[model samples]
Target: MIAAFLGMRLYSVLGRKAEHEEEIIQGRFKQEEEARDVPPPTATGADSARVEPVIAGFPPAIERGLREISTADRNFELIGFMEGAKGAYEVVLEAFWQGDKEELRELCDDDVYQSFAAAIDEREAMGVTLDNKLIRIEDSTVHSAQLDGKIARIAVIFVSDIASVTRDKDGNVIAGSLDDAVESRDIWTFSRDIRSDNPQWLLDETDIG
Candidate 1:
């Protein structure tokens, strides 16, 4: 009877200890799982306050104009605008060469579209086609930027190498050679109405850089 009583006392103590250890291990595993599930911390207001606005590399006058434009249009981003301007330059040149009036109409304002259309008409009358290829854009920069009331305008200067050939109706190369690339510098202005919901900017003006 004494032996049986000792055995029961030992079993009770050991069982309670084992159950407590199991509960502790289970709790630890749960804590580890929760830690793994936690998301990374986002930037807080104080952290964001430490960040500065990016400055566009330009002259003082141009920077002031850009600032005004930025104030007028909250969504205006200089880098994005520069990229878009470069793309537009290529697209407009290609469209003009191919005499794609519909595409030019969408990209240019009324006056600019009229100018491109007139050039296309003249080219068609001469029975000459432009076989032009934009080799590469060497440089592109914002020459000027301004906010005129609700309309924001930005002019970009693009320097590019282009291989151009004038082909006659008989497919004869007449003027330029494809082997020779010419450096073309052009200033193109893009304008947008900040109050409008449309995010697109139209080519409003063009000039030799």
Candidate 2:
């Protein structure tokens, strides 16, 4: 009788401990489930009123043209396109000035390619070579834009400085600078068919200033 009583008392103590541990586990699970139900913090007050749009600092004509292009091409971005134009400016001039017709053909139109070829030929016949290096592009702005049917034409004005000098076949400085950088302004026009899949814009015309 005594042994049976002791065994029952031990079992009672173990049952209470087990129930206590089960209660702790259930409480933890409930806390975790409750935490998941809470919503993320809301951005209230002035934060809710802030809305950003494309900022324009161009002339009314340019702004209107940009809007037109934006309507036609949803992916067109002003700041990014301007930045790319600046890079293309450097690439095209670097190739043309160095008499790389193949590279020029990839960047410019047929007439532009022919003109560049003629200039290069003239320079070659004169037995004078040009050593030119772009120092920096000071500024670049879109002068105008027009959408004619499916084609989009944009004229950009680029102001740049370069270190350049002309030397004869025997290496004589004929013109320009070898050390000092000179500024050059060019109004370059580019055209592309917006409906086409090709994203490359061709250099159509240029006016030097």
Candidate 3:
């Protein structure tokens, strides 16, 4: 099941080459310097009733939820959050494949971290290692967004192509092929406390889309 879910398809010449390069994991939620410096909008007595502009094209429910989240957290920006989510997806996948538990712990919530750690432990017991490559990300969009009190959760649907291979202790390919890439659709939810000073969001849930 894992093998079947972890194959990739090349989207372009550049993507094909990128699949072979070492994964560069950077700050998962780092925003640009200029973006960070910009202060959140403040409403005085007259402008207190002003409603934030909602981005169109999303479903009514999603739009409502996003608006609620934005209201709760003045620093929330849809475009920047989506970009950061995409980067987080790549970083988390590569860290899991490399069995980097420390990195995974920092990127994911406790429950999610435990799930990934358990999978790594199982693979180690079997004397097998995953060789997975994210060939291309075809799409990454917000599927849902909601705010519960000061906690905001956003689920993103990621449509990506991955190449995966399982190697035995002797370095022989035991399952999957790197040449064949398959599309995978995953819904991953990230959550953050709007009241917190830290701007980082942690992966809390994952599902097949």
Measured by lDDT, the strongest candidate is 3
TM-score of 2: 0.71
lDDT for each residue of candidate 1 in 1-209, tens digit (9 for 90 to 100): 32243224323321221111011110010111132242111111222112215435578878888788666666666665666677677777887889898867766766666667776776677677878899999999888878888778788888999987777788887767789998878787777777866566777777777
Q: For residues 1-209, write the lDDT of model 3, one tens digit per residue.
A: 53442322111111211112112233234433243232211111212133344345689999889888877777677766776788778878887888899878767776666667777787777677889899999999889989978778888999999987888889898787899998988888887777877677777777777
Alpha carbon lDDT of residue 177, candidate 1?
Answer: 78
Q: Write the per-residue lDDT of candidate 2 for residues 67-165, one digit (tens) a residue.
A: 676667554555555655676677676775677877667666666556666667766776766677899999988898877776677778889998876
Backbone clash total for model 2 is 0
Give the range where candidate 2 is weakest over 10 consecutive residues by summed lDDT: 20-29
Query: Over the full model, what C-alpha lDDT does candidate 2 score relative to the true structure?
Result: 0.59
Q: Against the true structure, candidate 1 has what lDDT?
A: 0.64
The runs of at least 3 residues in candidate 3 whose Cα sits more than 4 Å from the true structure, single-residue gaps closed, are 1-54
Q: Among all windows of ten consecutive residues in candidate 3, which has the lowest summed lDDT?
A: 9-18
Which residue pairs does candidate 2 place in steric collision?
A: none
